[model samples]
Target: MEHSHKAILVVSFGTSYEDARKATIERIENDIIAAFPEYRIYRAWTSRMILSILKKRDQIIIPNVCEAMEQMIDDGITEVIVQPTHILDGIENHIMKDEVLSYKSCFQSISFGAPLLSGQKDAETIVHAIGKRFEYLDKNTALVLMGHGTAHQANAVYEELGQLFKDMGYPHIFLGTVESSPSVQELIQEISNYGISSRNCDSADNDLPVEKVVLAPFMIVAGDHAHNDMAGEHPESWTSRFQNAGYEAESVLKGLGAYQKIRELFVEHVQNAINNINE
Candidate 1:
């Protein structure tokens, strides 16, 4: 319960997967601390389901925005900056904003930072980062980046980014979502239009356009969705759909947070909020 005049509350949806939590979320937090050592860093998770699961199963507790803010007030912290690790300004970000704003008067200054795909520039930077990360792939292989889609209007960001991936000098790199448009099925159709086949059949008719795909999670953490919905053996999973559609599938089981560039972008987001608070 120590007090620091300035603090950065790093907020996320949170995951119970120990390895993913460590690789993505914890690494982002560590990068934030390294970038802004002067300011104390705290953590908050918006998902009540995840929080409850962690508390009951793992015996770990992470505060939500309201609780964290109150804790800051109790500890005599004045200025506050909240930086969400979400991919877009969707339902989760909206919740964080509303809750964080409730305690505006409790701090000298309060600022909220942009999420990963905040603006055009962020998207552009992300494009190159992903391109470089998967540069090892050849023309015959497709990269299907799985994103956690939202019900909110912000869900459009995924489709927008989907278009951005097309012919942006990153060949056959596509995006799919679990919730909305540009779903894996939709991407299947799109990929079909590109003739990126996965058929390595054993029949006499072997003259097929063969291709392999690398599936990766586009979200900050490769959690349940990455393991279940995206790569799970279930017939409805993206991996199965791709396989059923006659394409070979390989899942990367990695999240955006594992990349240093993505982590650095998050740190930049925190720094941006800090600068805005000072101004």
Candidate 2:
């Protein structure tokens, strides 16, 4: 039997960190490519606005999913499967899904792969991924993760990640959102209070210096937020805020997606979605 699948579309939210974004997308694409060598892999970016801004600055070329689909057809592809590389069911994934639906009439079959972080299994995989990247400092330092929170119900997924860290036995893990609950200031206050609480609770026999902390973004790429908000030395940035609060702070520029385990999670997501296509 001849398998006539056209291509696997890997849709991402598009990152300014061009190399980093390509690496992450390629990791997932390679997995699908290896599994279905007969099917071609097409890449699509969901953030047209971001890509447009990058294009104006000569940063990146804006990718169009429709055009890519049309190209696949022109190349003699008859069946198409879109695998979104988004982390959540947010605007990016929604936009990609809508775009894929628009081409349903053109293909014999059109299916979607799953998002990176979706259900409990996905959350656990992400936690495992993050865990493998960092060893506990033993400095009683709080690890704060800044996520791109949204107004959608999926924003609650951030809390799930917080709980995952808690369940992993991390003593002090805090979740902050760039756009929603537990705002940056709120996170700073929480960290300050935690430091104060820790300092005041030390017993005479257990003398320990004020614990230093590390701030890292929970995003998929070390893009603008990671660079400007978390790691930047600006007076208003998280690193500066932590220093002003009398606690040492450092930032890890790598996002979760850059980690190998995290990359594997996306592969699992794609595999599961492809397996479930018949169901």
Candidate 3:
């Protein structure tokens, strides 16, 4: 490997599921490595619970932000750039940023990248990226994205992103949270309104009421939230609720990190942070 004074530390909330852990989080890290080959890349998990579970069950050991930073500093890395895989500027991301900043003096320059939804056009960009994937859906289908909500004010990011999708002329797309406002009931109401509106419209023959719904996780990893809260066969899961309400519902068990364009956005954020440090 080529010796470099700068290093890139990718931080994530992490997942316990090995398949999801590989498909989403590891894929994002790999993309970052390809983008900045000159910089030594490292990964750190913010979720101590997940990390502990992985260690105990699978014999997998992953470092936290503090430990990763310590290794970088010990290796004489004078410049370090921290890129987070969080989807929003919520409490988790905020804590990650603070942790990265705590090791500032250990390096000559330390820069932290913004989360996925930080920039003005991020929402629109993400909407387009995900929208393109489900282009085959007809007017009778609704897309419901389940996000991990937060009490932090940044929770509004999900609502704003959903609005951006609507503003982009995709009204059938709905956003719901696992822990905040715009709950499942709210999503049902919104989708029901759209269904009613479609039925009332006397437009062309192609126009039809939404009788089918697709549920997906608007999260970085399709772990517990996606597997249980969003798609589990439980009566309260989003898929189950949608089915119980009369719409044929199915869940896509994948994360945003599975998308190429989405991973490119994280790479862009890392570049932006590095550019800021250079400036």
Candidate 4:
């Protein structure tokens, strides 16, 4: 399993947010290129809908694992390694893995990389990344992370993130899903239970209205969910939901991949996967 023959495939769930998604993918690709300069590099997007929706005449269309590997084979590439830029081993990563495994015969060897927040080390890195972006608010305010939860087992990772935030001694960190358990409504109820009013009220000391509460997504890119579901003006969105609940809600559009520390997790995962192949 020599590294020289292998072509590194960086795969992501893809995003409709053209500029935002491109920046995230480019950073990961640049990091891999920097580390494994000897290995040929290819980029892929796992979401077909996203790719189709964000397609541009000028930008290179992100290929899938099979398509990228086929291209590598055409270029005389023998060995191949795939690194999924997904945040977890969810549906997107599972699909990529299946596609890569189907082409095992095409290459001398094939290796798959781990998701961004795979293990404890990766989790710590994520926590560090988030910490860098937000400071722990006082007991009066809490940080809420909205993740695109799935029915898949990987969705439990959202709970892990919540626990991590709790262990970090942050003031009552809360987690919610866009599609799974611990739904946004549940999270809102829990937050309201804390007596943290979502409304702007005049400060007793300053005599001025003070807004409290910050909401951020636990996603890799602030794509559809972040833009529409979390921050959209729609009445059913999390932002509107929070507002209706009497809380001032603010949405942080930056996804997990936007953080340098989180990006480093991708690099570490790629390196570890490459090392495993060597072993």
Candidate 5:
């Protein structure tokens, strides 16, 4: 096989769910491969727990970012681009960037791609991309997105994302997180305050005013948090609460990475990073 002097390392938090990995992470990787046929591509995961789980349960072996970089340097690949699948400039992304930078001297050059939602325009772009995923919802149904929020100050990305949806005339679209601001209860209250709740019923045809609520993950990959926290049968899950509240709740069970537009944004970010390297 022909070798390239440079390579692209696709970094993700990784998932134990093979199907989700295919639908989201792999799809993004494939897009990157298609765009840069001359450059070899590699995969690295950030979540040691997920990597360990996959190794034990599925016998899947994937390297972490540092390991992948060491392998690349050993293979004579001198330059690298590290593209992450994180949804925001949150804790995970910051750590990933730091790790990649620590290996900068090991390579001739290294550039890191921005997270999925980076700047203000990216927030708007993602709102439109994710919004397109739920065009089927009617006025009587609320669309609630569950993001995997971070303890980092960058958790404000979710807040900004939610605000963009509302500012763009999608007030019925609510955003919540499993580990940060705008919890499910907070989003439910937002829905209720918007008069899209059973308590504000208007007619039997519409039933509970807000007859249904579509729940989807706002994260890059719909792995553990998406399944167990957002859609699981557990009483604490988002689906359970909405169901108990007399609303028809449905889970999309897909991540933002599953969307074409979202992937395009990542590709654009990679291109920007590559351009920066060229400059």
Candidate 6:
């Protein structure tokens, strides 16, 4: 293989689900490879648990960010760009950036790209992508996007994206987090308040009641959270609640990384980070 001093490190909170890891994380890395073929691409995962599991179970050894940086230094690479697949600028993003920045003096030019949903425009793009995906739904159905929320202020991205759905002409859509506000309970209430509930034809316009609700992961990779928490048979799963509420509930079982537009945003962010070398 040819050697390159410049490298792109595609970072992600790795998943143990092989299929999901391929569908989401691998796809994103492939997108990066295609966009920047001139630069060699390396991967680093933020998930220590996943790393351990893969190493123990499959004999696969993937380095963490710190290790990856050390490897790059040993390889005599002086230019680096770290791109995270995290959905928000939350704790994960912060930790990754700090680790990458810790090696600032080792590389002549090192930059960290923005997360998947970094600002207003990113939220709008996500709304449009998801809106297009669920355009088939009518007023009798609601599309609930489930995000992996954090206590960090960046968790606001979930609610912000939810409102953007309305502003972008998809009022039937909603966003909820597994760990924060707009929680499952809040979504039930939001559904009820919006008159989209199938129970209690209390809405003045009974015909407008939602007959179905689709749950999809708004995170990059739909692994454990998507499988067990969002669609699992457990009684508290999102699917179970909607099913019990007299609505036909379905889990999309796919992640944001499955979308082309979403991948494009990450590519754009990487380019922006590469450009930072000049500044």
Considering every candidate listed, which one attains the maximal lDDT? Answer: 3
Off by over 4 Å in 5: 196-209
For model 1, residues 1-279, the per-residue Cα lDDT tens digits are 554589999999999899999999999999999888788888999999999999999999899888999889988889888999999998889888999999998888899889999998889889889989998987668899999888899988888887887657775789888888788888888777666333544555333343678899999999999999999999999999999998899999999999888888888898898888777
Looking at model 6, the pairs that clash are none
lDDT of each: 0.87, 0.74, 0.89, 0.77, 0.87, 0.89
How would you order the candidates by lDDT, starting with the best?
3, 6, 1, 5, 4, 2
- Which tens-of-lDDT digit does each residue in 3-60 have in candidate 4? 4566888887877776777667777788889988888888888777777765664465
Q: What are the C-alpha RMSDs, in order, of all predicted structures?
A: 4.3, 2.9, 1.3, 4.4, 2.8, 2.6
For each candidate, give its TM-score against the true structure.
0.93, 0.87, 0.97, 0.88, 0.93, 0.94
lDDT of 5 by residue, 52-111 (tens): 998999888999988998899889999898899888777788888888888888888998
Give the winner by TM-score: 3
In every candidate, how many clashes are there? 1, 1, 0, 4, 0, 0
Residue 4 Cα positional deviation in candidate 1, in Å, after optimal superposition: 3.0
Tens-digit per-residue lDDT, 1-279, candidate 2? 675556677777777676766656666667678877767788777667777878888756756787787777777776677777677888778877887788788777777777877788878777766665566566466777888888888888887688778788654777888788768788777667756666787575432334676888887777888889777888988888778877788887777666777767776666666666656
Among all windows of 10 consecutive residues in model 1, the one with the lowest summed lDDT is 201-210
**Runs with alpha carbons beyond 4 Å of true place in candidate 4:** 1-4, 56-60, 136-139, 196-211
Model 2 scores what on Cα lDDT? 0.74
lDDT of 5 at 264: 93
- Put down candidate 6 lDDT per residue, 122-197, tens digits, no spaces: 8888889999988988778889888888999988778878888888888789999999988988988788777734
